[model samples]
Target: MRRYAEVKTANMLMAVELSRRSKGQLRSYSLHPGMVATNTVDKEALWPAFRQLDIVTSDMKPKENGFERWKTIPQGATTTVVAAFDPRLDDKAGTYLVDGNIAMKEQVASHAVDPVCCLLLE
Candidate 1:
């Protein structure tokens, strides 16, 4: 999680710098698909524990389950599309987005910002 966050931060910073240097209207954003039908849930070690926990919780609906939901892809895509194309977002650089909403600012640890991980984002 920390590594992923760092890579994302670096990518956003890079986008901000690139837009500034080019004098173009641009914004940087990030998103997480809450739950979509993907093999990652079945295959990723990181997700199974959470998936099992969700199953155990009666209040956790199938729509909320990462492995079961199909509608989330389109819903999740909206956030990115909005961030990229919405005129209201113009000049809003260095913003983190989640689930189509502006994300709260948080400090990320330096160790997570591995150059190798940052390069992967490129």
Candidate 2:
């Protein structure tokens, strides 16, 4: 996803540049929903393995308590809404977001940041 993000960033930058040249006001942004109890996390292949380990080593059940410890859909939507409408973010362009705040940049996996993934973003 890193590669895809990088490419998407580039694409957003280009779009912003075009908008600027046309004397238009616009902004670009990105968001992350941290530890959201979404299908992507629950249905992942390793989730069962992780849950099995937790059963033996921890008291929490994966479905009932493990992943649910994090944010739900509404909680996750806060960041998305903030990025979309926050006046403080008006001057911020191509900002990566998480939890309604700027996300710290991190090194993405090589595969995630590859040219192929970048194209996928387009």
Candidate 3:
């Protein structure tokens, strides 16, 4: 989660810089699709953690899990698709998105608003 946050911070910084450099001709976004079910469990090294989480949270799974029990591939693609093609978001530049909506500013890091700090990360 820390690494994710760091990457998101860097991404937000890049988005801001790119947006400025492009003179409003570019739109960049950082986003997460929640816990989507993918072959990562079998192909990557996160299976042990995922398996343990599943065992612990199985009874707490909600009906909105995206499929019979877990998040589907399509569900994971929704936010990316929206961020890329949503006309309603024409003015939303240098933003973080989650579940197809703009993420709260507080959810991003302070560095995201500081070009100097953002550059330091690079």
Cα RMSD of all models vs. native, in order, equals 6.1, 6.7, 4.5
Model 1 clash number: 0
Q: Which residue segments of model 2 deviate by more than 4 Å?
A: 1-24, 41-69, 105-122
Candidate 1 stretches greater than 4 Å from native: 25-28, 48-71, 106-122
lDDT by residue (tens digit), candidate 2, 20-59: 4444466766556655656654445645555653421243
lDDT of each: 0.54, 0.56, 0.67
* Cα lDDT tens digits for candidate 1, 2-121: 666666667655655555545665555545445554454444465545455463234333444444444456785777887878776676654556566655445333332333444544
Candidate 3 per-residue lDDT over residues 7-115, each given as its tens digit: 7677778877776667778887767776766655554465445545552234333334332345688988999999899987778776778778887777666767566
Q: Please name the candidate that would achieve the greatest lDDT relative to the true structure.
A: 3
Model 1 is weakest, by summed lDDT over 10 consecutive residues, at 107-116
Q: Could you tally the backbone clashes for each prediction?
A: 0, 3, 0
Highest TM-score scorer: 3
